[model samples]
Target: MGSKPRILVARAIFPDIVERLRTHFEVEDNPGDGIWTPDALAARLADKDGAFTTGSERIDAAVLAAAPRLRIVANMAVGYNNFEVDAMTAAGVQGTNTPDVLTETTADFGFALLMATARRMAESERYLRAGLWTQWSYDMFAGGDIHGSTLGIIGMGRIGQGIARRGAHGFGMKVIYHNRSRLGAKLEAECKARHVGKEELLRTADHVVLVLPYTPAAHHTIGAAELALMKPTATLVNIARGGIVDDAALAVALRERRIAAAGLDVFEGEPRVHPDLLTVPNMVLTPHIASASVPTRRAMASLAADNLIAFFDGRGPLTPVNRPVAHPRGY
Candidate 1:
């Protein structure tokens, strides 16, 4: 039998997936799902040829320098902001991310968060659970309407389009979106969405959802100034990565009622949320599970596994985030 490549499963994944990887490579599986420090991760990766990672892991120049044997890092999430692409390319390392598979699922969660926020569902639930719902009152948890309201989406990618369709068709909402580039006229008509400038979308939207990717440029895409642009009665929902919205600034806005309510599935420093957000009654917080549906999560894991398998089998990686310099020495 030919020698198999050594691979590291950086975080815990399905046992069946681990077995599948074992068939092709010598697998070092972390079934406990321990959160590894950067130093720990680099040390572990030192002897490995490839790794299966998630958004939680930061693969950068320092880490790459420590892992000379590492050639590929397959991230199981659509966002690869945790990866330093330029560093990986310089180190001749291939990086891949799971995209498209989780788009619809994530969009579903985004709308779900929007609905929950606008309707004051979480706040009402807390009131009920706390035994505070003594009598029926008209103003008790009165919230913004969803149907026929304007929906603004930032970052009009596949997931953004999915959210637009959900709002326009499913809820009879008017959709406006801002992206780096506008969508084709045909797609715009199909989604029942209008292309708008970012400032316009922020100022006019009754409900604004962030679906943009996280980059250095995208950091704090929504800050105090942008929050100030939103209507006092508008709702904000973020299903995008943390740091895209300044969490501390958002918490202050939510506390001051700069916006009516906010729903977040991701945070700047999650699984640790901003303490100020927790104190705000109008805010709804969820652990980063926008694409946490069973079928979709499984599909994402499957795709990451497929990318790893395909890459080591002498085929080019699927969903490559960077084009690595081809090295004569095999990984």
Candidate 2:
């Protein structure tokens, strides 16, 4: 084997990032951005010592079984739910994700999606594009007010706190949040947020946003019953992971006007939205670009690369999701 560690960049990334990796390891980069099948990923990983991955790739037991030489899987996104962490830990594979770098950028997108959905921006744009704007009519795309409205946030992490700060301070909205645990009094006061139960947050807020992580337990956290709880005038925004909201049920709610509108940056089976959601006129959808600001994305890719370089360099990973059984030595 060569003295340098072998690494695979599983997805296309910046050329600069690839060059940076080349300096440290024998880099096998998929610059074409091909979506690798499990077998193909395994085949490529068979001899590699580490990998750089995005959220689309799933590194589970089967993949671990194939890459016996793999020491680390560095995910370029914040959410590592795509990774089977327990399996990676058992197989002595360390996992790391980019978190803090994307917080503010994602939060900004979440609020933007919320505002766009609330004001019926998508619907209005479609109307104009269809040449339907002959004259202004009363209540033509009239939507709910964001200022002084109740903003409910689920999963009060860094991004959630960022959204709360924007709503509470910039928009003069009342903020309430539900998380795995409550924030301290000082933090809550700073954000002007009140901790509430999930049910209350759903039933009361004028707008509800989901920023929680996805786990088996958290799958479909907002579904038919949960959507039924929101007021008819309310809007829902999801900048969280796909499968967190049941796309089918959400589509039904929007079609029936059960809620005013919805903004989805992530979907259940994305890049492929639900057929029903495609037909709903009251929703704003984006292709998972919440953390996609140029600088932020570069930082994310750099962080993922840094994790791989650090792990093979014996310095330890900067944002390790799990401690591996043994560190890479003599690489």
Candidate 3:
């Protein structure tokens, strides 16, 4: 207890945040931001009491076994899908995540992606850049309208509610949402969103947006069948985690014009997108950056750092995704 707690920051973060951690702990940080495989991550974690991990790091049972001294992991993301949460808890290791900080920023990016997809902005940009615009035709680059249209949102969490508020209030959209549990009456009225079944939302909405979390049950929430249900003029936007949509199936749907277009910020096994999606002109793809605003990202890192500091200081975790016994501070 006399020596400072030794911690590893698994990914490159702001130097200021690292320095803050250093003030309270023996800090080892990644300045180059290199990706670490599970074995590598375990090796680095071997002697540490705590770790600051990003979404890409896999903290599984095997990794946990290798790091017997490790007790807490602070994840710099809203989604703890990267963590084997059950295993961490079983091993008496606390896991925490950054939430609420990036909700509005992510919602903004989701809407922007939806607008770009519906308006054919990216496709048109490619055409112009390639010098393929010989003449302006009345129907040239004409795309669907967003205003006063129906908006379908899957997984109505905080960020999803923000997106719903934007569509319902800002765009005058009739918002319908599908979630594991329906929002309360007041919450629904506040966002002007209606609770609906998944199939109905897919069949009828003018634009469908995915804001769901990643889990085994949520894997491939939108696949070939769901895509086929959508109107041929409909648009699909995913700002959610990868594996929510079957990327290969989406590629085929876009290639066949089954759906008018899709804008994806996350993909299955990205930043390696499906080869077929690349060939489809009706798709807009982005790296997973929905929560990428400068201030928001820094806030996320700050919260993650806060979790590590708070737990070790006996104040308990700020936002723990799992409850592990043996809190050194006795929560």
Candidate 4:
């Protein structure tokens, strides 16, 4: 067999993972955990056959043109927007993403964010910290309940399905979802979910969680119009990609109490959140760490590593984003 192909890992990862890649490829890992600019990435990828990447690493048209030898990019995150997929396809490069493995973990986080927001958990904690909790009152931080409430999910993918099942079966909540296509009757029956039009989902739900993929067409899927449709007491949660919601508009809605509150784990132009969002009292904010459980993150890394190993071994990638271009440069 030819010598092992060269691969560069764009960010610092588990050393054991580096060792695993070292076994199959000439691995150049970022030991100091420095963020690579696009030019630096292009320079390193020029001679490598593949790369292991995270969402922050952008492999755009310029990088693709510079790295003619690049065959595959295995992204640790489920979203692959960092990749210029069309440009990569045109340049004969493959892309893989880590999914399924992080579904339950991410769903757990989404639900947690929702509960925190609805219950005014963060704001309440801050109140106590500021010595403002002198005594409990009947209406002190009164918030909505998850039980028997309508839970709306946008995007019916695996993670979204996990959330639906939890809301319907566990919380005794009514589950409604909106997706590009309808789920089969059998699956819907199992989750006790009803598929509805986007507008109806927004207006009727007590809680709305966004889990849809990001694309130009899906930009601002929830914006001024949709936010205006939501109930004044509704809570919104987003664990999906940034840009899926109009951050500025949502911040405005929250500040004015147009909607009850928002729980956000991702934001537009992250890791910088909109200043307006920061000023809102009813909103709960977190860094983009929905899939950050130790075990789950390890699973994601291992799955991405497995994709790299499988691709380089002449077997197809384990979870390819685009099947036809799964191994463009060949083994």
Best by TM-score: 2
Which rank order by TM-score, best down to worst? Answer: 2, 3, 1, 4
lDDT of each: 0.92, 0.94, 0.94, 0.92
Measured with C-alpha atoms, the lDDT of residue 55 in candidate 2 is: 88
Backbone collision count in every prediction?
A: 0, 0, 0, 0
Better of 3 and 4 by TM-score: 3
Comparing candidate 1 with candidate 2, which one achieves the higher TM-score?
2
Pick by lDDT: 1 or 4, better one: 1
What is the per-residue lDDT of model 2 for residues 1-331, given as tens digits with 9 covering 90 to 100?
3399989999999999999999999999998999999999999999999999998888999999999999999999999998999999989999999989999999999999999999999999999999999999998999999999999999999999999999999999999999999999989998999999999999999999999999999999999999999999999999999999999999999999999999999988777989999889999989999999999999999999999888887788999988744557786
Off by over 4 Å in 3: 329-331
Q: Which model is ahead, 3 or 4, in terms of lDDT?
A: 3
* Candidate 3 lDDT score at position 235: 99
Candidate 2, TM-score vs. the true structure? Answer: 0.98
The C-alpha TM-scores of every prediction are 0.98, 0.98, 0.98, 0.97
What lDDT tens digits, residue by residue, belong to model 4 across residues 147-254?
999999999998899999888989999999999999999999988999999999999999999999999998999999999999999999999999999999999999
| Model 1: per-residue Cα lDDT over 267-296, one tens digit each | 997888888989999998999999999899
| Tens digits of lDDT, candidate 3, 1-331 | 5688889999999899999999999988899999988899999999999999988998999999999989999999999898999999999999999999999999999999999999999999999999999998999989999999999999999999999999999999999999999999999999999999999999999999999999999999999999999999999999999999999999999999999999999989877888999999999999999999999999999999999998888888999998744555322
* Clash pairs, model 2 backbone: none
Error of 3 at 189 (Å): 0.6
lDDT measured at residue 172 in model 3 versus the true structure, 0 to 100: 99
lDDT of 3: 0.94
